[model samples]
Target: MTDTTKPRIVITYCTQCQWLLRAGWMAQELLSTFGADIGEVALVPGTGGVFQIDCNDVVIWERQRDDGFPDVKTLKQRVRDQLEPGRDLGHIDRA
Candidate 1:
């Protein structure tokens, strides 16, 4: 994506696992933080323990590989790193 273009973030979660809430919550976090910095935050329903976050078609996080769901803070940082690498996430950026 170009500097003028807003990247798309897609969150794929396992519907069978009832992880939609988590995915939605992540979407909320991203939207709340990035706001106009991002174009879209989509929630894709998947299965088989799949919980992945994709930005501009690149897989940033995966549940099975990571071994667990990411907390909202961590996930937001991952997104900010992609969307705007130098952008600050306020309190979330602090350790």
Candidate 2:
């Protein structure tokens, strides 16, 4: 699938180490929900709680961090917005 563009999503957490795990969980959920391929996890040591999610050459959604864990609602919205167009993830077959 060299030519094929898989769905790529980046999940970020707050500078605090705790958010790393939390963000990872959210990223996993999104991966399972959309069955997207090419899932990516990025951690920003210094930033304003921002995470980026890129979906199959369709859209790039950024997630803002809060004091507590990230809300799933925001994630769902971003995914929906990106997948709305005909991006075609090609295949989400990953173990």
Candidate 3:
């Protein structure tokens, strides 16, 4: 079970675009980096070329608005920033 008190991450991807693998991979990456720091990483299916990542209820990454996908480092940084603004992700912060 997830801790509701912690932050939730939602990755919504376009099902029609076959972005499941991409979304799943991103979820895995977030989980790997955040571990128990995060509440849960959910893979939500969507359409219309949507690929977005949300931390809590805030939209962190939107494909259309951001103009394409984020690299793993940027994703991590964004998530870390949202969850804990002052928290340093070691190498991630440096890189």
Candidate 4:
């Protein structure tokens, strides 16, 4: 988490649903928001619900432990408001 070189993003998913879909959605959201800042976002299959985003390097974002994905809109707003722009999003730990 202290690593500044990695990409920072949160990916959430439904406990009963496939995490890949959730990760894909998260990638889409990031692409929509950050655009070129994020080079790419991908779902890593069968890796404990991990989503990998490729920008400067490969940054991994894990889904919430519990069921149900977080609202993308809310997450975007939170990152925009709470997190410093250009800083790694992975450094921010959610409750």
Highest lDDT scorer = 3
Q: What are the per-residue Cα lDDT tens digits for candidate 2 across 11-78? A: 54456445666666777677666664444433334356554544554434555423344456665556
Ranked by TM-score, the better of candidates 2 and 4 is 2
TM agreement with the true structure for every prediction: 0.90, 0.51, 0.95, 0.44
Model 2, stretches more than 4 Å misplaced? 1-4, 15-17, 36-70, 85-95
Choose 2 or 3, whichever is better by lDDT: 3
Question: What overall lDDT goes with each candidate model?
Answer: 0.87, 0.52, 0.94, 0.48
Off by over 4 Å in 1: 1-4
Clashing pairs in 2: none
lDDT rank order: 3, 1, 2, 4
Q: Write the per-residue lDDT of candidate 4 for residues 1-95, one digit (tens) a residue.
A: 23445345544333344666666776787667766543334344544443333233322222343233456654554445433444545434344
Error of 4 at 46 (Å): 2.2
lDDT of 1: 0.87
State which candidate has the highest TM-score. Answer: 3
Q: How close is candidate 1 to the true structure, as a TM-score?
A: 0.90
Candidate 4 CA-lDDT value: 0.48
Off by over 4 Å in 4: 1-17, 47-67, 78-83, 86-95
Error of 3 at 49 (Å): 0.3
